[model samples]
Target: MSRDGSPPAATQGPASTGFIPGNKIFNRRDFVRERFGAAAWDAVLALLSQEDQAQVASVDPGAWYDVHLVERLISAACQQLKLDDGLLMEMGRFDADRELSTVYRWFLRLIRPSFAIRHMNLYWRRSHDTGTWRSWQNGPEVSAELRDWAVSNRAMCITLLGYLGRTLELFGGKLASLEHTECRSEGHATCIFRTHLELPADEPRPGRRPTRADISSLARELAHSPNREALVEALVTLLRFQFGCSWVEVWVTGQEDRMQLMGVSGERGPGDQRRFVLEVAGRAVGRLELELPRGPGQRGVDEVLAELMPWVSIALETARVDRSEPHHVEESELARRLRRAREIGQLTPRQLEVLELVARGKTNKEIAAVLGRSEGTVEVHVTNLLRKYGASNRAGLVAMFWGEL
Candidate 1:
């Protein structure tokens, strides 16, 4: 100020203007966005790894199985990738096997991230050099360890594929596909899976993270569901669509800790049963349970369930209120007397109009204007209608209307 002008008139230095050293401003939003993006990427990787491990664990290499576990895993994964509304539809084991091969092939072509895939090639060397399917001897090079690892790896691959497929499928509409190819060589079994990865030009990209408003809207919708049955139905619908569960049920607790069946959805397997307890506001309200597939998880479904828990608790509280006993009512003698008077007197239309207007706290002049009649006419109508209504005055008429309606 001293250097540039006559007076230092309301001047801001470099620090106040945010141009000085150590004057940096941090934005919490931008920081959170960066962190969330990183976390999502990490989660995707972890899920892929976990699914692979699950598939591998389900295999027995020594057994003469017609269908490979890896193939099934891939199929389940691909179906999951393509599913709509985060639902896991029921598919047989055989179908899952077919799907794995399909997803593996598709992923190679479309979403070909730099990942290695090992396909198992098995063969039997006959004790005699006879080229037949039967009477095969163990080859010198193939050890038990190798065989076990192959089966395990295949299973792991399938599991990984199932989860991956499901995750992608939830997003909808051809973001990926699966293809499979197997080759038979001289004396060994070999399956070469060429997963085709296709990243189409018009393929949809990842969407923006849900805002607080979006979460709030979903919560409100969940809360506003009409009744307990409707709320339980919503929960069942969520499990079916999201987790691909076989069955779901909800229970509400009443006095003396007795449980009531609130709602049930889907059918369970033979002799299968499960249960969960629901608690809200430091009190046990109800429970939810479901029968799930003994396979890789559908995380999208789990995520949604976790998000809905608070809303679910809120719904239970609402149900508790509805379950309470209703208010008591007994008609007083004065109420009875009014009804008798109204029946005895046949009040005119004008009188009825004036009576209602007076009960609503309008003056005679106001009632006359509303009815398009003279104030005197309105007064007379009031007198007659009051008699017809069997009320002593405006107060009695209001009470009578409240009781009858």
Candidate 2:
């Protein structure tokens, strides 16, 4: 998708069966070979050839390739350089200049046009002479396996780091540091690449990390939020402050599979952002999105989100229940009893299927046949239902669940 949240069709070149037209002009492999020398390039190719015979047979540097192949080649290159993941990632953080940014953007579009890559300027300090400028390169389409490999290896992303480092060098900035704060492989919906400019020694340090007390207080506030709108607002505010994000928004599934914007915080940038689904009772109900900023303090946001989502779910469910009209106003006392009984029973989904069959006057053998479970398992479900609901037998369990229309 484009950075504006539109489909790739807007920027897409002429459609072709093999490769997107004009995309073959920029070959990342060729760029690497020219930059790093022939020996390093040959070593990377040897590793790629070992992994896939097809790669060896038909090595076309100018051709558009799948993301998986690119990732494999990068992994191999990392190995050949004899650089640990830390050094490799460190190599990615170079100074950013306009020419470097333009070249990087071209390479990104050529290789992964489907990704939403945007460059944003950061406000460092009031003094313009300090030149403590920072920029961010956000890639939402990063592969999960690559992210996982980075996290497990305690390494930075080689592809993005390499592009950023080279761009910085072209801009006359020495490589300082690069940090991958958020990663899809680390349970975030997007990969955030933060670039810190090589500031002078006299420059002040960046802001301090968000305190644990601040996060805990936000969690408490979310839990106590009176309604869904309030809950959403609290969440967006907390995330924006906690992460120093460019923007944050909540999108919930409304009627007809459409997404409804619930709340937003910070400057609304282009529509391109990362989306994380919010699930309840094994069903997707909403999504949380973020346009992350170029800064620090993203290390524990995932864990914080994990801790806070239950409250968000509860608030959403409460709002849904409030908006829904009562359908059981004319229900009989026996029907109400059955409903309460089921609520108190706490049956598993499989057990509930068995209960529905029992209510249909099905025996254990019949339920086993219908549900594809063994007769023994069906018997166990029935027994648990009876015991949980204080029923003496299968008929009593049925009486607790069955009622007139």
Candidate 3:
């Protein structure tokens, strides 16, 4: 939870009772004040015991405080606020974001999740004095176990759950599965959490806005496109691949004020979504909508849309033809085939280039010439391609490329 990378003071005496950083208690109180106003936080204090009331008033952000009092304050606030218990995660997420403002939070976010899980206790220990947090990271799967952590209730556990999830978001990871498999609240001796995070190192992090260079590249690609559908496809593909949008759609407004779906990209997955109005010369031309893999937003949509204004403006104008339009643009058969082969075979970059050139009706020599590789290397790639495709020769490869026997 100390993601701000600012290590807490080591002034916590070795005490039997659990002690947490005073900043956390202060942050929670501040959250109540910011969320429900100052009077609401005062109401929360009135509900607490006299001992807790005094401690809450004089809590020092630099000192360690009793977690028991903090837990009670949380209970009273929740009861008075009538907040859904699930909002505890939201509160935790808010706490995580607040830490992002600290120096070195960026470094923490950039490290791999595996490293974070392995060394998470170093930071947790800075704030928590009574619990042993153990973690095991196996490839993409992470298992976290908390031992000797005795809390009055599960409220703190749920808040930590939200905190962990938000930290993963900052690390640019998408959770395929996250579950509190075991909890002290459930009569388990040690709390346990299981998680599977999808971190594709080759793929750009989700929630990042398109860069200026990315928009420039998209403009160049769109410039060479022959037709309206091709333009739409180019824009959709770039958004999906470049910035990790799960779904992208562009809708063009016609002369009569009717809207037409021009193009789409990526499978519609459950995630966060943003919608933007595309304008040209101050007139609304179309809408650019996209969904990112579900997580806290890393950047603003307006910044992303602004960077992509050049490509979006051109693509929108090109797609406004409104003639012989399909629901969406489809990739060429051969391009689709090449992409399918690349994915299915898990081809290397060179193999992908060879396969694409071959599908484009290039011979091994021509592929070598195009790729700046020797004919023998191209032949080796072609042979591997034949074996992967279950084809005997180059001729058979081409035939199978078109779904022919």
Q: TM-score winner among the candidates?
A: 3
Compared to the true structure, candidate 2 yields what TM-score? 0.27
Off by over 4 Å in 3: 1-16, 202-405
Query: CA shift at 139, candidate 2, in angstroms?
Result: 22
Scored by lDDT, the top model is 3
Q: Residue 156 in model 3: shift from native, Å?
A: 1.0
lDDT (Cα atoms) of all candidates against the true structure: 0.40, 0.47, 0.65
Give lDDT tens digits, candidate 3, residues 324-351: 4553444445445756776778887567
Ranking by TM-score: 3, 2, 1
- Give TM-scores for every candidate, taking all chains together and pairing residue i with residue i: 0.26, 0.27, 0.46
Clashing pairs in 2: 92-161, 95-168
Question: In candidate 2, which residue ranges exceed 4 Å CA deviation?
Answer: 1-40, 49-53, 56-62, 86-156, 165-177, 198-405
Q: How does residue 379 of candidate 1 score in lDDT?
A: 73
What tens-digit string does per-residue lDDT give for candidate 1 at 110-156? Answer: 22121111111111120111122211112111111122122222322
- 80-188, model 2: which lDDT tens digit per residue? 6654544444344331222234423322222211111121111111101112223333322222112222121123244446545555443334545555666554456
Q: Between the candidate structures 2 and 3, which one is better when assessed by lDDT?
A: 3
Q: Is candidate 1 or candidate 3 better by lDDT?
A: 3
Write down the TM-score for model 1: 0.26
